[model samples]
Target: MSAAWSAGCVRARSMLSRRVGAGGARELASRASLEEVLQQLAAGPYQRGIRPGQSLEDAQRAVAATVLWHLRVLAGWLPREGAESVRALAGWFEVANVVEQVQQPGTPPYLLGSLAVSWPRLARAASPEQMREELAASPWGDPGGSDPRTIAVGVQFAWAVRVAERVPRAQDWAAGGAALLFARERFLAEQPLAEPAVRRAAVLLGADAVGSASFADLRARLRGDARWVLSDVDGPGELWRAEVRWWDRVARDALKLLRTTGFGPDVVVGCAVLLGVDARKVRAALEISARGGRPLEAFDVLA
Candidate 1:
């Protein structure tokens, strides 16, 4: 790690320490309405983008923008070595942009903040073939380039590959790969295999391990470090629970990284991840509140 990367890590540590923990998130989640939520958030850093009467989707988008803006600021403090890791993480949003385009080409883009500069070009493609051709030179490569469904699978597959290749730690890579496999299998299990692109993504993401197979088989193929995520899952319906479990593991790993006094790209990545988790928890809590439920009753802090 260069001196600049270390310096960036130091700055990230200072910023991350001030993040709202579970207790604070619960307070935000306990609000009775969007107006109350806005008032509470206005007392903090989120007040700038979030406004009164904002719909849930718009509020979430604003929250995303705030998080990405923080990431951009952190990236500016790092050297290329540190900055590249942050950018790699942000690249997920680029894949998301493609997914949105495939799902709704005519609709305006919902995600506004992205580190990838080519998102505009990729987002403009009206059809799967055009999108695949546009992404031919990108890291997400072409996944047989057929239709929107196939292109979506290909984009997700690309993300799985990048997670394994770009993350610096071997253990973290294994966890991430396992999470992808679990989510993909659970989700695609419902989709008909008549689509060739979906079938390809299934194979690439190891979805076959869970298809028409017993939980025993699925558990056997998972990475050893990640097997615990499925210790309680018995069937497909329980997969979302397993996802939350995996997120807990991720949060723990990130917290462990942040605990160190040292500074580097890993610290920057940890801060970004922790902040993202915080936002997700807040959203989950607020969603529960919107549904006339109390905070922390439905969702708990993973870390």
Candidate 2:
């Protein structure tokens, strides 16, 4: 890992440690409740009813907003440097405008076509042999010796479409149908992946794009926390698939935003406010992170 990435991770650890505090990593390890949170999110109305031409725009905005909000919180979240980093990463808001123009029940076709375009560019880093092996893998992980990045994204598109396919039908759903469904699957499974794996998985699943960061900073910050055990991040893994060139972009943008002048905690607060989380809980988590970089009752705050 580069020094910058390491520093960023260290900062993340420092901030996270303060929030979780005193054996808090274990709490987070077991806390993957999304149903209650989803239910709550669903109970609330969408910012506005979707108009005939607004579905895609709404999806774009919602996804972008959600990512920006979470990242913002994590950025300015105390432990000054970590807070700053989160703030810095918020710059690439343009990424969020991706699918803002498609129609309803929209996750499948719209996102599929997007993958066709995005996947190729993303897989440019993979090697020839790695690409060949990947294509021989899952429903979409295959590269066909075509463009590995494209193939990678195609798999992500498939995963998301599959996840969206599983959505529970209900009145008053807030986010897009696919996000809700995929999130539901993740929560129901309560599958806890290592932070990096989850980060990469989320990218593959098309949440936000990812870039690898240096682990040194994170290592230093994580020194005090047991739950920050990085077993999952280290692996006898796919060499090509292990890290990405752009993951750092996510972190950098977050950092830049945090360093901007005149933006108070409210930006972060307003961002979080939009998340459907109890403001008090997020605040408490931030407060804890600020104090000692511990993990908050992040898992328990939902629902």
Candidate 3:
């Protein structure tokens, strides 16, 4: 690795060290109201994101923006290869922003820092079809069709392939893409696979694995880190738990690699990914708390 890459990794590792843990998120979840959650956030890394008298929606948007800001700074410091991997990972944010714009046109923007340049065009999209066309010309590519849901999934699949190519051992993205395809086949759509993502995943996971009735056969077809997605997952109701577990395993493995390897882009990329997952967990917990639900008996901690 170059000296710049080494220095970037060191800086990123330092930043990752300050990320909130699962216990802190659970504490926020235990709060009786959104006000209390904001109070807790008032004194932490998320404090800057919490505006005075901020509603739950506003706070959530701020938190999302904060996570993107961290990623932006990390990407700016890394070498070309490292920056490429980080940008590839950040592409997921752009996909999500597209979905949000399609679903809620007038909503405030909470996009990735790297994608600020495109926000103007996306914000002006009069309809979902127009937004889809705009994304087609971008790195995210066409979502196979004009439908919003399909576009989201297609963008995700494209991102998975891109990340897998740019980052070594980044199998989690492919696994996630496969999981979504299987979920759609088994529970949501219950039809033959037609989307490009499903076909690509099928090449490695088998053409019949997605629609198969037997979970064992389906799991057996997955390779590398993708197989873990099916562990202990019985049906659609249990899929969320399975995903949380899978991400936990992926994040831990990334952290382990960061620990064992010498200075390189992997460390920077891994730190960004782990931090992003941590932010996801925090957001999930906050949503439950905002709903006035009880403390996380049904939720799996994502540290």
Model 2 ranges off by over 4 Å: 1-35, 43-107, 111-150, 153-249, 261-303
197-292: candidate 3 lDDT, tens digit per residue:
576556445566654575555666566456667766766666667766767777887787678678886687678877877787677667767877
For model 1, residues 1-303, the per-residue Cα lDDT tens digits are 677877788888876754567777777677777667766766676665777777777676666666777777788888876677777766656767887777766645535343664676787677877888887766567666556766776666566556555656424544445444544544436443224334433433345543534456666665455556667677667776777877787788788777766666567878988877777776765576565545455656422
- Residue pairs clashing in model 3 are none
**Cα lDDT for residue 208, candidate 1:** 50
Error of 3 at 153 (Å): 1.9
Best by TM-score: 3
- Per-model TM against the reference: 0.83, 0.22, 0.86
lDDT of 1: 0.65
Writing each residue's lDDT as its tens digit, candidate 2 over 51-141 gives 2233333433443344344454454334453343233223223112121111111222222221232333323323545543543453334
Top candidate (lDDT): 3
Q: Distance (Å) between predicted and true CA of 162, model 1?
A: 0.8
The TM-score ranking, best first, is 3, 1, 2
**lDDT comparing candidate 3 with the true structure:** 0.69
What TM-score does model 3 achieve against the real structure? 0.86
Can you tell me which runs of candidate 3 are displaced by over 4 Å? 115-124, 189-194, 203-217, 301-303
Better of 1 and 3 by TM-score: 3
